[model samples]
Target chain A: MSLLRVENISKSFKTLQVLRDVSLEVNPGERHVIIGPNGAGKTTLFHCITNILPIDSGAVYLDGKEISKLPAHHLAHLGMSRTFQKNNLFGDLTVEENIHLALAAKKPYRYDIFSPLISRTDIRKETNDILEQWEISNRRHVKVKHLSYGEQRLLEVLLAMASNPKILLLDEPTSGMSPAETAQTSEMIQKLPRSVALVVVEHDMDVVFAIADRITVLHHGEVILSGSPDEVRNNEVVKEIYFGGGAKKHA
Target chain B: MKKLLLGVVLLIALVFAMPLVLSDFGINLATEIYIMAIFAMSLGLIMGYAGMVSLGHAGFFGIGAYTVAVIGQHVANTYLLLLLSVVISGLIALVTGAVFIRTSKFYFLMITLAFGQLLYVLFWQLKPWTGGADGMSVSAILNFGFGEIVSPNGFYYVMGIAFIIFYILLRLFVESPAGKITKGIMENEARMSALGYNVRVYKLLAYTLSGALAGLAGALYAYFNVFVSPDLSGWMFSGQVMVMVIIGGVGTLLGPALGASVFIYLQNFMSTYTERWPMVMGALLVALVLAGKGGLIHWLQHGKSLFVARKRTGEAVSQQPVKKGEAVH
Candidate 1:
């Protein structure tokens, strides 16, 4: 059975139709990527799937259960986790604190008056593991606002991972990064547990080609193509519309 | 950990010994300070941590005070009346917070202010129950089941304990995941909503919690002072709470208390020499603003040495960090 399934999802903002009859599916442990030219509504699709925006028409299901109408917070409680195109980690909190909070969201703990946060050994261990994986252990006490830009982006994704989600929704996970940082993020994405199904929206064609098991192409709020990376790269229609006739570069 | 323990011990000692330091005039001043600190703390909960700017905490404060005064005037058992007053004020807060949290920042501030002013007018116009402009007085001080609570010193101890308990409670809330979500909402509501939490419900809960605490302080004031008036609901009173919160460093748990203590002392010390006490307060506020740089709390938390280090490092970097709501895409 598909871990995540979208059925004829459509959405509009004000008078503008943003997504038109979009449908997709990710089977368990599959890595899926959605790509399109600018204004392709990749972000919109992520929003719909994550329940950030109400659909004009359609349904989203997780594990065959309808969740098209669930609120974002409830969806999170239902084990859906997502990262934004932009870094959205808590600025004032330390790196450990941010990860700890994400962990706390997953499980209830003794957060009472007079009790210390340091006493929660399980949370501390979990936070330490995430911090170690993200290579931010040395800067655990550093606030997000004080971190380097690339580090902040990594921290954002790390925070999303700390929630121990079943399915991850990442919107442009490598946005605004240097070439080195982009490569690092790609490696990190590859390093994530394969058991966690992923639905990623990305602009970098190389990154999409490098990791995505399958690609879904959207243009002007409609799916233009859906296939394997080689199939999409060789498609004459995709070349004509998005790739400038395929002369410049190839992933 | 040792330092924190020492600090708590010192605070406890100060609270216990405060009553001995007070003369008759000093006792009244100290009582007002305790009440104002609690009022400021409630405002801190919403404004500091939750990022809601409330300019009408005085309305909740007045509601609490009046509830006690009216009930105390009629009921023979003062303790029961105090308890009832706090409960009633909390109910009002629950209803008001439910409505107020639905709106955005500017709208929230304006609506709360309007509600406060409306309460003020009602307190003035309702001559029979509220005693109109003259105000109303309680028949006697409260008597809890354990013993009679009458002496100014005795009441000081009660206020002191309550402040400590609430301070600890508020600190816990700030550190909780729920509290972190509130902080997140303050940063970006759109992001928070997208993350799946009901932004409105969390904000409303925080506002209600804050209002209940403010009302608790007000109830204490009514019984201690033996009177309640429309002045409690006035815009000026709201402004005072805002000033105290700002001076103390908005989100810091201990900051509001320290700010209130300093403000009360300043008011008491300055009024002895001048009829223009308001003007002195204004000048003092201006001086504080000038010295604040970032904010009083920022200065206090970072300290002068750290500020210098931060400035040096910040200049070396020279790029402005990304602000809230700026998406990478």
Candidate 2:
């Protein structure tokens, strides 16, 4: 069964239709990337799938269970987590504390007001482990606002992964990164464990082609095609629309 | 945490020593400050940690006071009355916060102010129960099994202990996961929500808890003052508690309490010499706001430079020693 399946979902904002019959599926361990131009409704689709925005029609299923009507916050417990296209970090918090909040949300006794978070050695241990694993332990105590833009972007991805979701959505994770940072991020995304399925909305073509096992092309609130990387690369329409005639330029 | 512990110890020391040094009138004033501190700290929790700035906090405080003033007329047990006050105030908060928490920023402030005025009108019109606008004396004696606490010193000690306990509870809560999440919501609600924390539930929880604590303070105030009035729930009183929070600092656990003590002490001190104490208070608040050092508590922590620092004449590292032809922008 697909880990996450959005079937025939449609959305509109005011008089403008934002999504039109967008259907996409991700199997376990699939690296599914969505590539599109600006205003292709890629982010709107992510919002719909994550339940951040209510879907006008059609249902979204996670592990074959309907989740279309679920609250956005509940989606994380159901193994669906996502990052925003824009930075949605806790700027005033230290990097470690930000990670702690993300990991702590998954715990059952988080509402226990009598127990201090500092006394919870288990959570602290996990926070330290994740920070060390990410090779950012030295910067753990630094306020997130002091972090570089690229670092904040990376931290957002780390926070999304903290819940150990079965399916993780990354919305333009490398949107504001420099070329070097983008390549580094692309490499990191490719290295993520296959136990998690990735659904990324990206404008960077190199990142899309590098980390994507399969790609879905979106244009004008519709899914142009969903296929393996080779099929997407050879498709006449995708090449014309995505690459703009023969020359390969970023969309 | 170390600072918090020191604050508690100092508070205890003051509780013991203040009554010895001050007159009965001074003791009475100090006792009122302690109660107001609890009230201010409750509002501080929602404002600083929960990112909810309410202008109707005095409503909960008034609820607590009126509960004791009216209900205590029948039930003389101090514990039962106090519990009733806390529970009723909390329940009201839970119901009201459901709708209030839906609004954010200015809408929240306006709605809370409206709710507070509604309570104020309720207390004013309920002439038989609340004694109307002139207020009613708390007829029940505060007897905690041993004896009636009628002496000013005894009431002072009781309020002092209550303040310390409430502070410790607030400290522990701020260090807890739930409290941390509340702070997170204050900083970034979207992130907390995306991380699977139910933002509204946490918000409502903090709001309810704050209301209950405010009620506790009001209940104690009714006992201390021997009267309950509609002004207790008035927007002016709510605004005063907010000023206390601002004077003390917003986020720190001890800040609001300290702010309350400072405000109450200054109000009493300034009134002795000048009938225009409100003008003095307005000026002080203006200075505090302009200084913007996070409040007096924070200002006191940072070297007390305003009083003790000596001006040092030195060369600025960036100021290139007036290089012969260099133009200074």
Question: Which model scores highest in DockQ?
Answer: 2
TM-score of each prediction = 0.89, 0.92
Error of 2 at A74 (Å): 0.8
- How would the docking of model 2 be graded? acceptable
lDDT of 1 by residue, B83-137 (tens): 6766777788889888888887899899999988989999999999999999988
Per-residue lDDT of candidate 1, residues A123-221 (tens digit): 889887877776677788777799988888887777677667788888898888899999988888888898788889998887898889989988779
Best lDDT goes to which candidate? 2
Task: After the best TM-score superposition of candidate 2, give how far the Cα of residue B140 lies from its true spot, in angstroms.
Answer: 1.7
Docking level of model 1: incorrect
What candidate 1 gets wrong by more than 4 Å, as runs, is: A110-118, A245-251, B1-4, B17-22, B76-79, B145-150, B188-196, B273-275, B293-298, B304-329
